[model samples]
Target: MKYKKYLSILVISVLIVSCAKNPFTGKSTMALVPNSQILPMAFQQYDQFLSENNVVTGTAQANMVKNVGQKISSAAERWLTANGYAGYLKDYRWEYNLVQDETVNAWCMPGGKIVFYTGIMPIAQDEAGVAAIMGHEVAHALANHGQQRMSASQIQQVAAVGLAVGTAGSENAAIYNQAFGVGSNVLGMLPFSRSHESEADKIGLTLMAIAGYDPLIGARLWERMSQQGGDAPQEFLSTHPANQTRIDNIVKWAPDARAVARKFGVTSFKN
Candidate 1:
């Protein structure tokens, strides 16, 4: 019981002390790891990953990736500047690459490093589709989801250690430890990840709209992905929201996105 009390105090202290505000969401998020440290590591890893993979260059598709990245990132900056957060992305080193891989995926790392797999291009079909994906990926970086994810993982690891220590010498110590691992992952980590995805979806839609792409494009892209025919994990066990859930969220949020874009003199959308 004493060990549990100390563990709880330690966790609470860390949570209170190590938080950063997410400009996009206007929410305070966990940031146990500082970006000053995370950015250099991210830059190095991005360079290494590019070196190890077949990075496509000198192609129209590659140019589109660069263009879309720039547009979405610029839109993000515009929003920030309009909202009195000028230079918020000063430390971000934005770079985009298209790699020759068949995985239908795209991701952005900490500090604005981004990659788009060649396989996802077909589903994207056009520039607007690309913008949708770009906006979402860039939103992840802008909102510092990577930092939150890392902080959450650190907390999870610490909690595991706490569980083990607190359960020491108990008859069901092993069982307690196993349950803690599974319960924390499913109940805490999974929900945390899903919330990030949804937040990204909302932010990305607004960004795409501000970048002059139709915000509804995000929902369309997901609809196409859903038709690609694969089973998604149950929502409770998945790190991302279900495909239908994402589509509905984007659709519901599209009008709001357009309204946001209008605040920046963007009255038209492109598809």
Candidate 2:
């Protein structure tokens, strides 16, 4: 019976790992959570978050946030449709908000709930900078990085549980505990977080270019971000890639993104 249970888990894990594809790169991906389960939950949580937060209203910045979001969302739609994935965003409830906050950060949750903190405005420097950030956040959602991370986490939990169960009666309890700690901390979290950041950077550039925002500006945005270093670790040591690495990758990938944009009649973008 125990062997049967383990076999079932192994089969389920294999199935979960097989059921994903990278939206931007068209690569096979590992995701355990189905979109049907993740999307509705993401939409509900986004709505609840907006209702709870002090979202800015009737302000120029807030309006710009919405405008940029709409542009990027449209760009994503066009790309998806052109790539034979039309209606891919049908379940996405896109919403953009400029929140009253002092943190120099921005993010988009799955299902297209985006928030721009007021403090990041200075770093944004202009409409293009805002677009750059918006594109990146939207890319994270489009690629379903959050869902992938969540799924990976679930797998990690399963592995940990299996380990604990298998060693419950063993004399190597301390070894098992140590292995679980190391596996969950290193194998489960850090690398997954880093991969999400890098994927977002790549997909974000494509989205920004498709939306008529210069993809090259992505590197400049990160340079400015690097200068505003606070208590936060340099991007390299954190979950994100280092500023230099990100800039280099953006510079390298911008031309390809522009080629993609050109297919959609975006030959040039605002500097």
* Cα lDDT tens digits for candidate 1, 19-68: 78888999989888899989999999999999999999989999999999
lDDT of 2 by residue, 1-271 (tens): 4345545675676666745676686876666788888888887887787788789999999999999999999999999999989988898888989989998889998888899999998999888899899998998888888887887778777766666665666688679778777866666577668777888888989899999999999999999998985676655346777788889999999999899999999977987
CA lDDT of every candidate: 0.92, 0.84
The TM-score values for the models, in the order shown, are 0.96, 0.90
What's the CA RMSD of model 2 in angstroms? 2.6
Superpose all Cα atoms of candidate 1 onto the true structure and report the RMSD in Å to 1 decimal. Answer: 1.4
Q: Which runs in model 1 stand beyond 4 Å of their true positions?
A: 5-17
Which runs of model 2 end up more than 4 angstroms from their true locations? Answer: 1-12, 15-18, 231-237
Clashes of 2: 0
- Winning candidate number (TM-score): 1
Cα RMSD, each candidate? 1.4, 2.6
